[model samples]
Target: MALSSTQTDHLRRVDAIGDPPARPTLVPAERYHSPAFAQLEVERMWPRVWQVACTVDHVAEPGDYFEYRCGPYSVLIVHGDDGVLRAFQNACRHRGNALCTGAGSSLRELKCGYHGWTWDLAGALKRIPNRKGFGTVHMSEFPLAPVQVDTWERLVFVNLDTSAMPLADYLEAVPTDIAWCGLGDFRCYATMTIAVDANWKTIADGYSETYHVQTLHPELHRCMDDVYAPQMIWGHTGKSESLYGVPSPRLSGALSDEEVWDAYVYTQGPLMGVAEGTPFPRDQQGAGQSVADVIAAQIKQFAAGRGVDIDWATTDQVMRLHQYNVFPNMTFLASADHLTVMTSLPGPDPDRGELVMTLMTRMPAQAPRTRPADVHMSAADAHPGVVMSQDIAVLTGLQRGMHQPGFTHLVLSSEERRIINMHRNLERYLDLPEAERISEAAAGG
Candidate 1:
């Protein structure tokens, strides 16, 4: 499942490393905590951009539905009885009541609880309570307001702008770049909605760069190559690739091979079904095999136990994590046998947001799909994983720091270009005036 040499060459052409800007990018701090700015985003940005709503597993069978909410917008994604997937504005036409609340299966129709206004799974208006009250009501004229819905691999995305570009087009070269990994074979088994006290961008920026790996994620730093992890930017989407199962060059040869293995086991043991304190398999190390090769072998063996065949995946394919960012609020980190998609949604205020992680596991091609278990928890109670938990724990202080009177703007480096690219796309969507747009910081003497 590894990329061919030709494909790797193509990837090199898209790599954005060694392309640093003339100076640092300066983004206003108010964009993180200003209600006015958040309102502008809600009005102009959130509706038009493509966002990951749920996985196809959440709505595989007919009558299944998942309600996706962001800021003031709510979208109802449904699998119709006609075997087609569709989305609506999640509001009843009559009294503007929500047609659905949470995720569930076996939904015959969407009926407003407050009023009896009903619609079929296809979003066609079906009936209304006491129809005589409104004499001029027309069924065809009042179908549930449609929203655009599409799929790439197993992830479902929605856009309120029906005229928006197709999902494949919006994704640019990302789908093709990652096509060798067999992404569709991984099925989401669970999702955790962790409530955090930070702006959605605050949560998203955490995953957009590797600059914090050494400081904020000491354990992850011991295992991943923070440096030499190249990035790519293609319009609304971007990518970052970090090779795991190796000591970071930052450590400067201080970590032994066994130490690297231990770090990997501590930070991501579940991927290979290894326990936290498990020692490296010194005996299983082949004549010329490296720690990465040993780890890849273990992962393949683990997948085999679940009837998922990843023997075709090379060490590079399994150890190099392909982290992708879809502008605004979504990032999915994937390897040959591992996948985790995360999205940050605006909360009640600019200083609050929800980090939703859709966890996936590789399964046999013939394996049956099931609805993912969706659970909500506060940042304090969310221990999804060692690395991710650390990411969530820092949001509280980061949000508060953004409000400091002296903290005018966030200075960025070329390493954090993904975050800068997000702001670039965001400005285009919000149509911010020149004074409000992100700019280059003054050059240092």
Candidate 2:
């Protein structure tokens, strides 16, 4: 397959990761189900690395608050009356009761439900039920334990380690890589948290590569050129770009333009307001325009209807999906008029995890902000999209497969380097012994 002009430029601009290993990469299967390893992640990785807690929309107005939980750790994010965003350890200073449970607006103060201890929106201890009962209890002495909080584009992120690097630095080159997409213009309208019976890494690995599209996502394969998809790595962050609205080059036969259109509609017609079984508008194709060009035009029209101007975007910009993966368990894919952010959080045990999806749409500048509708569902009830549903359906089996006695390690190809990069980052944080680190097997061994 030949690389497009934009793809050529993308390859030339960034410092690519090292070439594919000479043989299959091996990762231990026990990491997926080991209780001790999970504990290590909870202590070392979750507390130290920056993670997307919620979207700015979730806490857009003063007094709005959202609770983010990973494993047993909970962080409460609040929009203060002073026009500042703040996060705390979500524990009351007195008796260690949770100050808040879920998310809502119009919060006057952080009041503990159990003992009636309270704090101001800025996290300063303001009131105590009985001042005389406690000896020398200074309000200033016991403010809420602070957590580092910041925003990138419209997504809010929190880090328990106050000394961790700024979110911008932690993201490496990802921010500058997709600045052309104007991510700030996209407004999150909803989020879905689906409970899955799979390890968090199992859920995350599904998004880290395109290697499964040919077999697992046939409809997606017909609309995306997975073979020519290129990737780049930058320390804790990396990205993959795949052109859509075309048939996969791996397909044996040439598909007609209408066939390609149907595949795209079946996979992601909602993006352009197209209904299922909608036929391609043959008349819509102008001279020298390909199927991708027509799809890009339709997307532009959809954006204009919402008062969002994407006229400056070219076909390549709108048709290519840029996927960025943040270490541990965060991945977001964006195009000129689309954005979806996903994250996986560890559940009660190593065999369980939750996949949270943040759905966004491009909106006109100065669009009124509203709190996003957040919903939680079991895996059986989740139907985020055709492609996403497919991804979710395989998690349980993939997780259970790792526990088989004969399944010792996962053999990975270079196409899955993003997943490999995640393990590399995990090793740095967990300080795994040399014996547990990943290695490449010698060819034909």
Candidate 3:
């Protein structure tokens, strides 16, 4: 396929992470504003893509289940009595009624309350509840229809199009890239999910680049580089990533001592909540110590207290500083001690969408953790300001203005090459006919 102007810039970007090609095209705003366009995504894009449906912990035990809700399609994942994990169309095989209502466990069969049809966790039909009432029936033909389900490092993913590429093939370069982070052991530390009034892609795009950080999150500059240049914004195959930490290359010289500690105390200190959010001990050497030297000492001492050995010098980049956009709607940011997952899913309204944020960490092997109940945050609810509120305000504002006469498209930078690559990859899915997509996926794309 011939590259679009935007994609050609993306090809140029692949040569180096820090520089944006001189002339990336302006992205059309209609992609974010048009309901018809959103509907095309609903029909041609989302269904054909593989997405993280839920975490493995959501359905960890036999009979446990979680609803992978996207738009009006409610998918149910269950750890069945057969000791296997499975995904199925949440609708009953009979009369098209929903089979699962919400998430719960300890079930041997998924029984439809409406008409009493039931299926096993492996999606096998088990009962029709007085089969004579339906007269002669072919029970095999009435079993729950299955969705393609697979896992990678404990993330459960589902695809509605059975003909799309295998999950591993779809993941492309992501797995090996994140291997050093040891993500599998990072338990769910905290999770927050909310429905919102913005397009899912808009929210995904918000996290795709660091260009807006210096303007939107200046406080973070104290500890991490928000500068777009000199930041390694590498992309390969179908995935992309960028890192934080390492003082901004734009800084003329090494950070002053005060700059190091001030940045540390405000950012990493507060984040670690060292001594319950008070200033860290300052016990480490205070005079003439480089940032790396100070950080290396602190990590060694901290890990010593926790009875673990971490190669901080070698794996320092993993020290709470890397992130990746997992195509479609999932973004994962990992620190040495934790991982944050952000997801954007189509909303009930074409112009609006849903957002989910989950914090995964291993700060303490036995930290007290709880997954919070899903809540609906109003558009006006910018309670915990800064990052969340600023992003919400801007995206909602963009949503409102995108359709206006003055605004026609997005003027993106090389910093947002990830977005360009993402949209083009989406086009691949959108262009294929549904039957062909399924066939291609099943044949191992």
Candidate 4:
């Protein structure tokens, strides 16, 4: 099932031209409800792509390890004793049982709890618990399987496909774009994954565009460009994003553009993270500058206090904390001096999933990095951040509403090009032939 029957037919029809069906709007509801579609994604899409497994800080020391699970696949990302990062199938060599159920640290070697079969950090079998008990076991051929892995801007990613393209090529300009915002310098501060009663795409799509901000996250207009920027959108490593810090031209209700600008410049404090008591320069417009310019001046002052220098005048404030949606599941929200990294994994069914949200920023070099927080989910009032809570709060209802017979297709907006981009990319992976998927991924197709 595709976003719509037309979405499905159109894809098959125009695919000969090397372009995807233009799913600008009216996506089929089956995209979120079809079990076959979900299975296709799991079998065809998830395995052959580059996915963020964890942050460098998560496995900062040799022996520190974490498990990355997607569907039936489990990968153990280890900081090898060689002082390099490596990923391996988490199953034991003997009897193919999981070597480790969860994350742990300071393990000199991987010892299977099932039978105590052991392997070294180099993924070489070191011992079998019962030496004489395994006459048929071939130790030479039984080492943990390795997966393709790499790092960028402290993010560790893994690809199940051996032939997949190098991480740098697939990622293209994402790092460069983040570096431009100075977010490449930020470090992970706090991270958490929340289970949501919606499809992973539903949650990811919510963050990709600002089409719903005025109706969904009205408060965000205080400092966000709810409208998508066309020119810069394509420059984001071939991804789509919604910029922050600049007011949305599509104001909620009937507010004037001047009022939006006034709110953008004048609204201070936690709402926009302005210095606690920073006052607005003027009530109307600040010194005859555009919204982005006015925001830069105020933020530059605020950032100066924190010892970070930004190109105040020219820095596109919209990207100060923009949300960049990488294909598959990762969405990196690079804000001024920090980022909110988000990714998702499917649940028992694809319609439900776990969404991990990490609030990351630079801690002074001397500060110890904090571990990720436990899983949590709550309504707008209870979730830590009201903005985020609101997004999560509507998911359950949204998921159910998506299945309503009357709501058979999605009505997207111009600002929602990101969702379209993601879907098309997803279809590319799904439609790929099994034999070619791995090879094409390796080629960064």
Clash counts per candidate, in order, are 0, 0, 8, 9
Better of 3 and 4 by lDDT: 4
Q: lDDT ranking from best to worst? A: 2, 1, 4, 3
Tens digits of per-residue lDDT, candidate 1, 6-94, equal 23443354333457788888999999999999999999999999999999999999989999999999999999999999999999887
TM-score of each: 0.95, 0.96, 0.83, 0.80
Question: What lDDT is obtained when candidate 1 is compared to the true structure?
Answer: 0.90
What lDDT score goes with residue 26 in model 3?
61
Off by over 4 Å in 3: 1-22, 228-247, 251-255, 267-270, 275-283, 286-289, 292-315, 318-320, 363-376, 379-386, 432-445
* Residue-wise C-alpha lDDT for candidate 3, range 1-445, written one tens digit per residue: 1222322232333322455454545666777877777777888877777788777667777888888878778788888777788888889887888887767778878888898888877887888887887889887887787888898876788988888889888777778877877777666544566666788988888877767766765555554545422223233233333333334434525555456455555555533334423433456655653454455556556655655445543424433355677678888876565567888988877678877776555544454434434444665753433456677777777677877888966766666667776666665656744432211111222
Higher-TM-score candidate of 1 and 3: 1
Clashing pairs in 2: none
Q: Rate the local accuracy (lDDT) of all candidates.
A: 0.90, 0.90, 0.65, 0.67
Where is the poorest 10-residue window by lDDT in model 3?
436-445
Off by over 4 Å in 1: 1-17
Clashes of 4: 9
Comparing 1 and 4 on lDDT, the stronger one: 1
